[model samples]
Target: MTTPAVLLLIPASSYRTHDFLEAAHALDLEVQVGTDQSQVLAEVVPDRTLVLDFFEAEIALAAIAELHSRHPLSVVLGVDDESVELAAQANQRLRIPHNSPTSVSLTRDKFWMRQCLAKAGLASPGFQRFSVASDPETLRDSIRYPCVLKPTFLAASQGVIRADAPGEFNTAFRSLQELLADPELQKRGGERAKWVLVEDYLPGLEVSLEGVLTDGCLQTLALFDKPDPLTGPTFAETLYVAPSRLPETVQQCVRKAVEQTAQALGLTTGPVHAEARVHQGKVWMLECAARTIGGLCSRMLAFSGGMSLEALILRHALGRDIQTAQTISNACGALMLPVPKDGTLHTIAGWDTVREISGVEAAVQSLPNGTAVRTLPHDARYLGFVLVREKTPAAVETTLREAWTQLQVEID
Candidate 1:
């Protein structure tokens, strides 16, 4: 019998690559990274690394098919949103346990996801899609106030803006259009980058869910209560503290909505990361992805017997029984440090002091000193992340906030 080998789809610029690789190493699984970045080593190490056009499914499929024949991949794991659609397609063709291409594609498009949710009788916001090239002046009259205009395919809230009035709507729309016209974005998303989705903003407390599906059944692993109100002019998520402080009933409702959402999208297997808002006791589904939480956020989820979220995901994909995988006792949180401005990251200070804070587990500066950083509505990369654990959820959030204050990041 062959040892289970994974084709890990990691984008060239992804922040979570090292964590995923570390998890794979811990499990002693064979990994062949599939990335869009050109590899000079490809000729010498064809089996270890493969280049892929993540946006082009057919081309990616052809490349993956040839690789699979020689090294039989048991799991096609995607590390971020950019690679999910192709991962679904590759896994389908490889006869591996995976979500359908159609399902994964739906999760990628904001408009398609809203349509699916509304069709399934779930709470959904009124939305409309417009071409980025369209006249925002003419379309501004039809848009509802306090609506969000976002690039349909972009994640981590890039190119997402909130418009409250006619002037704000026009300004926000035009600004986002210019951003969507970026050549790099055009190459990555093509026409998916050429349109915008304007949806009536759902005002409420936001939450995130991390879970995995088994044969179409949803097994929720964590429900993170986002202490910060995401009433966004730009929604850069700040903190996610799990074992939620929400009422047990509200937590259950969030879980149920996510379960219904996974079923509605036809996602039967693999990790599912979902976002939602709770307003007046009604759970409104904001977004759901056919992958685990992004960035260092997954570190907050640790299971019994020293199992990480990535390990649980791998075990499930390998067809191993994970009934013993229960979350460790204690509340944990992650503070995703968003880039403050556009400049060279000159100096990052106080990391050592942050580590000394109570309940602080890890404080990472993912970017090097000279790397450029930009804020949201244009750039999607986070500056770094701070992870914490405590005896209670409130304490976790408190520790995260204090740890954040001690750090002094200067982008010159």
Candidate 2:
């Protein structure tokens, strides 16, 4: 039998590469990591890591095809949003099971996901796609208030704003229009980059789900409850506690809506990360991505036999017969420490001390001190993530909060 070899499409900035590499090592698979920038070690070990153009799929596929001809790959996995689309195309080219490129495209565009959900009678809000060049004065009177304006392609809540009145809406529109006009964004040259989606704001607490799809069948892995209120002019998501405090009935509704949403998007296989809002016992789908949870947040989950979330995803990508991925009994959670203010971070105190706090598994600082950073509606990266596990959801939340209070940061 040939040793299983896999190709992992990883964005250069993704924090998940280490975890995924460790998982691959644990599974004893021959792993090749492909990123946008050239890796130093790839010069020595050609199969170790190579440069693949994520923005240019044709060039990437051509390179992957040539590599595949030399060394047959068993599966292709993607770690972040940008890589997932490439992964789908590579899987299709390599004759490995994967989600349709069309479905993955729908997931990337926020408005497209809304249209699919609404057409399927799933929980979706009213939405419209508008070009940034269009004048907002013409549509202001006609458009509804209490709606959200967001970039179709941007994630991590960047350029997502809620406006409760016409004044607020106009303000948000102008702000977002300026953001969209940035040459860096315009250079991307896609409908998603040029346009923004305005949609009715779903009221209530927001939550997120992580699951995997097998031949179109959805099996939920974790349901995270966002304790912080997401209703905002700028959403700064900070924490996620799992084994949600919501009733089982409510969780079931969320699961059903997510499953239907995935089916509606025509996603057949691989990991699914979904966000939704719950109001008066009804669930409203926010957005779904054909990838696992982003950032180091996946560290919050613990599966049977201490399997990391990355391991589970990699195994599923390899077509292992994993019917169930039951997590351990303990409740788990993570805090994505949000950058407090707009300035250069000079120092972060108590981070080491917080790491020693019981139940705090990892306290990592993503950006180096003295690095300039901005708050939401502008920046997408988190300061870092602190993960924990406890006996109950409440305990998990408490541990996270207690650990959070210890961190004192200075910026100027």
TM-score (all chains, Cα) for each model: 0.96, 0.96
Please provide, for model 1 over 191-230, each residue's C-alpha lDDT reduced to its tens digit, 9 standing for 90 to 100: 7888889999889888999988998888989999889878
Model 1 has an lDDT value of 0.87
Clash count, candidate 2: 0
What is the lDDT of every predicted structure here? 0.87, 0.87
Give model 2's TM-score versus the native structure: 0.96
Model 2 lDDT tens row, 218-331: 899999999988889899899899989998999999999888899999998889999999987789999899998988999888888889889998889888966767998579
